[model samples]
Target chain A: MLRIGLFVVTVIGALVAAAPLIAIAGSNPLSAYRALLQGSLGSRRGLAETLIAATPLLTCGLAVAVSFQGGLFNIGVEGQLVIGGLIAGAIGAEVSLPAGIHVVVAILGAALGGALWALVPALLKAFRGVHEVITTIMLNYVAFSVSTYLVSPGGPLVSKTQPSATEKVKATAHLARIWQPTRLHLGVVVAIGLCAACWFFLYRTTAGYRLRMVGANPTAAQFNGINVRGVVVRTMCLSGALAGCAGAIEVLGLHGRYFDSFSPGYGFDSIAVALLGMMNPLGVAAAAAFFGMLRAGSVLLQAKAKVSKDMVTVISGLVVAFVAARVVLERRLESSASRRDRRRRDG
Target chain B: MADVFSINLVVSGIYLSMPLILAAFGGLLSERSGVINMALEGEMLFGAFSAVAFTWWLGSPWLGLLAALMTGALIGAIHAWLSVTLRANQIVAATAINLIASGLTAALIETVWGKPGVSPSVRKFGIVHIPLAGHLPFLGRIVERLTVLDWAGLLLAPIVWIVLFRTSFGLRLRSCGEGPEAAASVGVAVISVRYRAVILSGMLAAAGGAYLSLAQVGVFQRNITGGRGYLALAAMIFGKWRPVPVLGACLLFGLADAFQFRAQVAGVNLPHDLLLALPYLVALVALATFVGRASAPAAIGKHFIKD
Candidate 1:
């Protein structure tokens, strides 16, 4: 019940805060919100766009959620995803084989790329005692530079035709679109499947239990004979793998080629999504869907209301700030409620 | 000719390092008082945006600087409320602040300026040559070429060192960071000290942002700080959280920035992306290996919940 209240408060707060900005942009807040709802949910095309946006977010959110469960904060998802996409893009363009084999290789290559990118930070944290936060953040810039280098003029993977993107992946490797003329593709199914798989792995497996144990209490887990360091490293690797899949799916399903700066901060946005979902797979899916709707609707809002699409960013910021304050808010509410209960009993 | 070249390099390096030095000082205050300031990046962005906007409004870089400092302080207040008072996870709170700043600044730029990418140029801090220094030997020439903010940053470094080591406030702040419970037991208000330190940090960091817009660039763009805040944190770690050492670290980073610019000017013909990424790559290497050997404050990032 408290969780429900928190969610409601967050939504309302976001709306109220954004109202003035909407007004400043010469649009009524009510109509602007109505446009958002109608655009994202009122039509089939909008729904398809929302699902397409949600697919990568789901995978990225799962990546963050899994790492959180293992007592690691994998803020390097952005880096991992970039590297993963670069590898998949490079392979997708170069390889021309049977569809099944080609697609598998590209996806696997992406996962490996992500894991490799994450390995540096994990190793630093596990062996050298360096904080993952700074290392991961530094690696994000490295990933951007590397990706840009790869696709830039005079670089290894520069496209002869487009100049800023790589050659298209072979048709055989392309993930088929589920709906004609809409962006939704087989990647959505793959993302959903991965979500279920994460749920099973986290709750139904001994390894998952061990990971959770380490996350919950590292010293206690170490005392209980768990390889805490190993869990930390492996969890990051798995997390990177999940993020890599997000990049690969987006490429194979949507863009059809690798380009520099393809992701518009999906990796970063997923942090809030993971938090809102309580780091659970099911919750992550729901959160991802809601964000996807926002992403889909926000563009229409921008066009119709003449407001900058950047307003979505402000909304996101408000949500994260409110969510971060939840600990204090919830504690206060619980204490007041308990006091009220005592008074009623005494009376 | 070589003397001239070297002097130019050093001057440009100092210019690049001023913002970093200021931001690192801010981080030092917060961290020295037991508050982890991961939101330095966001605070710097807010500073940069407001500095330009205020300068455009008031036609005075001084007022712009004041506005930037206040904006940074406001961000720091939010961070303190979450991490100190509410006892939320410092890192999560900081990350949220960064996201919020990124979005809010961008939206604000778009709404107020009717543009999406960059803001209009504003009143900037004009250069003032030191009268006697300008006529001196090579060293004097170097000093004369430095911007007022650059010299201020240089002077502020020693001032920070003195304040941190010599003053009663510094001692209390360090005690809060190193042993919050002990400090609380001994009648020091740990929470209040942390709040002050964090707020001070925001103001200093905002000054850094103001330098970027008002002194160095004369305009604000989306992401104008461009990870300089993270670099400032790296500088703090590299300097072992000391004011003097942090100044040296910022200079090192500034030297790298200067070198990158020089290489570009000399037509080094490197891949644009590789050259653009060199500073960050250097930062990553420095952090992963160098900071692992440095010891941080004992009670850093730990919440002290009083009964």
Candidate 2:
């Protein structure tokens, strides 16, 4: 009950905080919210778009949640996602295989690519005690540079006709569309399955138990005969693999090619999703869906209310801030309630 | 190579390093006081946006600089409240700050300027002629062309070194960071000192933002700091959290930046995107080699809980 109440309070606090900003942007807060609801949930197409947008977010949120569970901050999810997309895109365009196998190979290739990208930071963190935060963030810029170089005009992967993009993924490699006329794809199902699998792996597996032990108390875990360093490296690689899948899904399902600057900070947003979800797999799914609604609805919010789509970013940021402060907020509420109870009894 | 060694290149390098220097000092102050200030990027962004907005409103660059400092202080207070008072996870809180700054600044750009991505150019600080510097050959060319903020950024290092190492307050602050419980036992106001250090850190970072908008670029673009704040954090680590060494680190980054620009102008056979990644690569190398847990404040990132 307390968890539910805290979650509700966090959501409300974020919205309340964002209302004034909406007003300042010359829109009535109520109308802006109405537009957001209408655009994201009022139509079938909107709902599908919400799910489509939620796909990558869910996967990336799982990535973040896993790392958090292992006591690692994998801020390089953005770069990992990009590397995954690049690798998947290259495989999808160049490799020839049977239909199902082609897509599978492309995605697995992406996971490998992301894992390789994360290996440097993971090893550095495990052996040298270098903080993963700075290294991962630095690598993000490197990833951008690499992607841009590959797709730049006259560059290696540049498409003949399209600017700053690789050739489209082969038809056999494409993630199948599920809902007709709504642009919903099979990637959403894959994402949900992945979420369930992550939940199972985290709760029911020995490796997961070991990872959690390291996260909870590395010294204690070491004393208990766990290889803490090895766990850290493996946890980071697993997290990077999930992030890579997010990128692969985006390319194979949504964009159909590797485009330069494709993501609008989905990887960064996943950090907030993971936090707000309390670093749980199922909670992350719900949080990602909520953010997806905001993203899907923002188009109409912009068109109907003249509020910029960037308002969604502001709202997400506010939600994260509120979530970060949730422990204090909960304590304040409990203390105030107790005080009120005492006053009533005395009276 | 010859062009890279020119006086003009050195001046540009100094100019490029100014924001990094200021922000690195901000990180230094906060970390030295036991607070992990990963929000330097966010604070700098807030400073950049507010400087542009206030300058556009009031039609004066000086006021813009003032506004940036105030905005930065406000953000610092918020961060301090979350990380210090509430005892929230410092990294998580800082992440929120960064997101808020990025989002709010981007949204407000549309609201205030009727556009997105970039703000209108405002009145910016012009060159300041140092007394008798124009008469000197190489030094004159370098010193005479700096803006007021550039001069401030250059002078702040020595001033910070003195304030950190020479004063009683500095000793108290260092004690608080090293051992807050011990400091409290000795009658030092640990909480208040941390609050002041974090707030001052914010002001300095905001001044860096002010330099970006009011001095360097003369306009605020969306996400204009572009990971320079992270770069500043890297520099702080590379310098082992010392003021003079941090200043040197920033200069090294600045020189890398200047070299990138010169390489492009001289038609060096490097891709522009790779060139853009040079400073970050340098930072990564620096961190991997120089930083370790031993160099950080003993009690950094630990929230104080009074008994």
DockQ, structure candidate 1: 0.65
Per-residue CA lDDT of model 2 for B1-307, tens digit only, reads 6766788789888988999999999999999999999999999999999999999999999999899999999999999999898988889889989988888888888889988889988888999977898999789888888998898999999989998999988998888789999999999898899998999899999888888888988899988998889899989988998998999999999888888888888778888877988988988888778746698899999889878
Candidate 2 — which residues are off by over 4 angstroms? A330-347
Off by over 4 Å in 1: A1-5, A20-27, A332-347, B1-5, B291-294
* lDDT at B210, model 1: 88
Model 2 CAPRI rating? medium
Instruction: Single out the weakest 10-residue window by summed lDDT for candidate 1 chain B.
Output: B1-10
What digit string (tens of lDDT, one per residue) describes model 1 on residues A1-347? 65656666766776787788668655688878877787789899999988998898899999999999998899889889998888889889997889879988999999988988888888888887777777788788889888998888878998999887889999888989999888899999999999999999999999999999998999999999999999989998999999999999989989999988888888988887788777889888987887787788887888886666666666666667777777887789889999999999999
Q: In lDDT terms, how accurate is model 2? A: 0.90
Model 1 share of native interface contacts:
0.69
lDDT of each: 0.85, 0.90
